[model samples]
Target: MIAWIRFAVSAVLIVTGLVSFAAGVIGNCRFGYVMNRVHAGGIGDTQGLFFIVLGLAFGEGSFMDILKLALLIVFMWNTSPVSSHFLSQVEYYTNPNLYEHMERK
Candidate 1:
């Protein structure tokens, strides 16, 4: 019973992670511009990765593996936003008519 419960929980988490990934893919495909695409990609990088790592951790029995996964998730959570910001800055500077897509505040 315990093993079955673990299996069920892990399966649910993995499925949730997959769904998050799917959402990100759809968002990336649907968005029109670089900044919008970066936002969509960031969703997958952080939330999708978090769920996937959390699911993997649930399946693993070893403490060290779980700790490593936890660290990976933390690292991703920290970096995804910074990378997105950098990409946005790059887009802002490089795009010749940035004002057409976004209004300057």
Candidate 2:
């Protein structure tokens, strides 16, 4: 059923978010580095947002509520990337050691 599908999707999103958070924490603690932190953060946002929207879909919500939830999901998806890009730019600029790994002439 559709409800089952929504529940499954929500579960998957929540698991993905948890895994990403764990990876971020482990990477920071083990290496004292923030490699892929932005990616992990974005994954957290995306998975968390989708999980919420899917939960709403499974709830006793009206058509308008579902529409609003969809809009929120779309907005989150759009803004998450922009925010990640800005964060990455800041990190890249502030951390010269990161760029030292880059191949250069």
Candidate 3:
């Protein structure tokens, strides 16, 4: 039925969204720390972790709930990097070699 199809589509979106969101969070956590090992500042420290937690928490329960969760996760996943970039720019400007070892150029 149409309802079942809708439900299936929503579920797929939610799962894929969560998976992508999780991967970004974990990646940023791991490498972000390594990039700033001595310091205690990175995307993982700010909205990144918060978004992931919120997404997971919000994703629970019914299909509608998961849809909202998926949307939040997608939004966070898209914006986290941009936020991180700004944060990094702030940190890098203050210390030009903040990530010297990892810097490509």
Candidate 4:
């Protein structure tokens, strides 16, 4: 029974991760601006990765596997936002009419 429960939970988490990735793809394709696409990509990088890794960890029996997955999640959590910020700044600096899309204070 416990094993079955674990399987079900892991399956749900993996499916959720897949759904997050799908949403990110849709958002990236639907949005027009590079910054918007970067935001969507960040969703997949962080939440999608976290869910997938967490599901894999749930299915694994070894402590080391779980530790590695946890580390992976931590690494992404730390890096994804900084990467997104850098990309956004790059877009902001390079785009000729960036203010056209964004409202000026």
TM-scores, each model vs. reference: 0.85, 0.61, 0.48, 0.89
Cα lDDT of model 3 by residue, 1-102, tens digit: 866665565566556545655655666566643445313333343344454545454435467766776676677667756666776667667865666666
**Stretch of 10 with least lDDT, candidate 1:** 96-105
The RMSD (Cα, Å) of candidate 3 is 7.2
Candidate 1 Cα errors over 4 Å, as ranges: 103-105
Predicted model with the maximum TM-score: 4
Instruction: List the global CA lDDT of all models.
Output: 0.86, 0.69, 0.55, 0.90
User: What digit string (tens of lDDT, one per residue) describes model 1 on residues 1-105?
Assistant: 988887788888888888888888998999888888998888888888887887787788689999999889888888889999999999988889988888754
What number of clashing residue pairs does each candidate have, in the order they appear? 0, 0, 0, 0
In model 3, which residue pairs have backbone atoms overlapping below 3 Å? none
The candidates, ranked best first by lDDT, are 4, 1, 2, 3
lDDT per residue for candidate 2 within 41-90, as digits (tens), equals 67657775676566656663578888988998899999988998988788
Highest-lDDT candidate: 4
Error of 3 at 2 (Å): 0.1
lDDT of 1 at 104: 52
For candidate 1, give the lDDT: 0.86
Between candidates 2 and 4, the one scoring higher on TM-score is: 4
